[model samples]
Target: MKRHLTHLSKTILQNSSSKTLPLSRCLSTQEAIERRHHLFTLEKKRQVESVGRIEKIEVRYKGVPKDCTLVMNKDISSPYDCARHLSEWHADSNALALIDGAVHWDMHRPLSENCTLEFQSYSSTEPQAVNKAFWRTCSFLLGAVAARAFKEDVTVKLHSFPGPDIRSGSFIYDVELSLPAWSPAPRELITLSAELVRLCRRGAPLERLEVSEELALEMFVDNSHKAKQIPSIARTNGKVTLYRVEKHVDISKGPLVCHAAQVGRAAVAAVHRIIGSAAGEPEQLYRLQGVALPAGVMLNHFAFNILVERAKKLNPARSPFSPFGEDGVRNMAATA
Candidate 1:
């Protein structure tokens, strides 16, 4: 009685005619960047417009220039704005904002309420948090520069970066590129380094934003991997943290350095192919790596070359290919 199941006919395909319409012209890497930047700008403007009324809050400055309470706009003024009022030195050197003796905030992230504020530099007494932030920023910039370095034909899909490890001697960015088996020449690496240098020279302030999971998904629609990760990232707090510099934007668990200029000397040292996966499928993942020093740090070319050579060795960061290790590669919120 159960033997009546029949397989569906194999082709219907024989009768169905297919037409290939001209493929929609794909966006160039630079165009894609501009598009994303436009979206980010519009959303940022909307958030600012959502603040119906201006309200003032006190931001008590600590450390150099003595402690004092300054009136700041609630949800409007940021640590950066406060710094600008004090001195140019405060505005430029500060990397992270220490608030109320506890929370470490992004300098560009707005002050939500009355809080005690102290700025952290690369040379602060307890600089662990600031160091992590600078490392993370370098990794983020690596993605931005590398993505822009490729030609229009090569697709660049940025994956997650493991949390910053300055001890490892390099910051990392994992990306999937269309050039599956391509090996980079020395000239290519030099070009990438030059791109990083140009970007840092722009001195763009790194803007931090928190948005809903839905919006995060919208922002990263072009990136399937990031879209997949956003749900898990937003699960904990129902929001995803994003950082933007110039026309490039990306997600991160971050208190990124105040500005790109803070990365004074840098080199795009190596890019290692990450092959093999739990699925055992051929993957196009590449780990773009670099070494960097803060603005005030001094190193001669010979000494810096030593650091570059050290960074050329494959970094020991967690591979995005490993889905089910200590933390799932897709569960970026955990590792990042």
Candidate 2:
């Protein structure tokens, strides 16, 4: 099975005449991911360097190995850093950092003030927020895989994913591909799923960074779809939140669970074509759907298959293409 998947991934990007390439694909999907990733790195480094005089804050940690107060760097230290001071298990599990028992903050996002902190994991008593984060991370990962899954001549632009609806049974990504019409074969879907699992196993943190609108626009200049959304997303705060995994970067208003390795028992169940509501220039975007359980959740194969079947149905999340230019275009209402 491993050998077959390896071969399948190699050939997944080969062009098929039946699925002819679009004229718009000047840069390959991998090229675009790399370009955006570079800008994200530079912006992140700049932000880190600009946090000049190091300030200290007291973080009242409220769980595991007894509650204790930790002195950490302000605007420079993240909950992830606190976890490191606690235990490797906390660090590796990628716990969701809950601030003051009220707000759920990303494990990696810097804490701005002196606040009480607690960690939440996939197996927490109330895992709703953690579950949502996991789902969003999966959706983001799906977009990364989908982009490079296509051939160089093919234009694969990520449209958007709605906020997480676990009851809807799958995480989704709406992508506008250059192909006029194409259907994924069973093997192709398996290949996509395999690629996602492979990525998760390799271990990558879903790092978060908030960039100015100008920088966000510069980062996504290669992709017209994201460029259109940045103006609206940055309208409120003038800052766009971005998440990066390895070399892939995308937009999100995120508190994503710490890492990708938490995603386990995954499947790319189906792909359906969705019609765009943007009048005159209707888009035929493909809605890619899949289901994933957090790592360590044990389910028999039969039950997992049932979930796979359910995810094959069309997701009911509001179409990202629905009537644009309206006030308040949201940051990709993602996995969560």
Candidate 3:
């Protein structure tokens, strides 16, 4: 099977008559990275350009510092923009923005018409949405960490991640590593955590983009696994959501934390080398697990140690692939 796959790859490369369609574009992992970034940039520009005339919408801001009205551009301003008008602290510390006291809105997504705005911090009374947003951000950031942590020789293909499940004790990321059957040592986990810390130090603002299925598949052409998932992900509304940090873009239904600086005290707890005995599937994969506390959550080392131990156990949330089935990674009810 391995030899057949290698021969097929060579054949595809040698076939000079194949039309270089956008989705059919031949690419390396590095090229895939660049292509996705370029697509995001272009999409953003297109959205901005589509607004033929600038119109103002009143946003009744109802959060910290003071309540006020913001005359924002229609379909142009986002909750993050409103936060910027309030203070840098508001803009940076907020995890999710609630519009009209309901509807969790992404910090980077544009405001459509008019609505009241409320910001939710990690410590808010109803912290469930905010916590979920934080967990999703962590999962997304873990992908970035995994992509950058790898040596150039190894190909790092991010598959996808399950929705955020804080009660399950940790955020999880499922990735395809070139090392078919490899497990990391404790020192390696520490090293990966250090890489995550370094990324947080850089402080990239997570940006969100919603595109048509055609565009989403085009963006993920180099990643077979993500491309496969796009159709199912878009089945609900024929729209695909993507999040970007710096030059990296990955799929997620997101209302991620405003900035990376909000993440603190994170550790890669363990890597579980999992094997699938079922027919017609890759035999081996690794599930990366980690525990984190938001920047201001001051848990003592003793309590945090307990969380770390719990995280080492397999997170019981739904799996990224086949999230709602018998062969599923986990049952969805567990996440609730």
Q: What digit string (tens of lDDT, one per residue) describes model 3 on residues 220-265?
A: 8877767767777777799988889887788887778888878888
Q: Could you tally the backbone clashes for each prediction? A: 0, 2, 0
- What lDDT does each candidate get? 0.80, 0.79, 0.75
At residue 93, candidate 2 shows an lDDT of 84
So what's the TM-score on candidate 3? Answer: 0.86
Kindly list the per-residue Cα lDDT of model 1 for residues 162-206, writing each as its tens digit: 888888988999888877576787877787888898789789999
Instruction: Please give the range of 10 consecutive residues that has the lowest summed lDDT in model 2.
Output: 14-23
Quote the lDDT for 239 in model 2. Answer: 87
- Candidates ranked by lDDT, best first? 1, 2, 3
TM-score of each: 0.89, 0.89, 0.86
Q: Tell me how far the alpha carbon of residue 334 in candidate 1 is from the true structure, in angstroms, after superposition.
A: 4.8
| Ten-residue stretch with the least lDDT total in model 1 | 11-20
Model 2, 1-336: lDDT tens digits are: 221123324543323321233223444665566667767778888988998999999999998789999999999899999999999899888558999999999898998789999999987899888988888888989988887666555677886777887899999998887767667778878888888888888779889999899988877766777877788787788988899988788888877888888888899999998876665333688899999988889999999999999999999877766654332135444222
Show the colliding residue pairs in model 3.
Answer: none
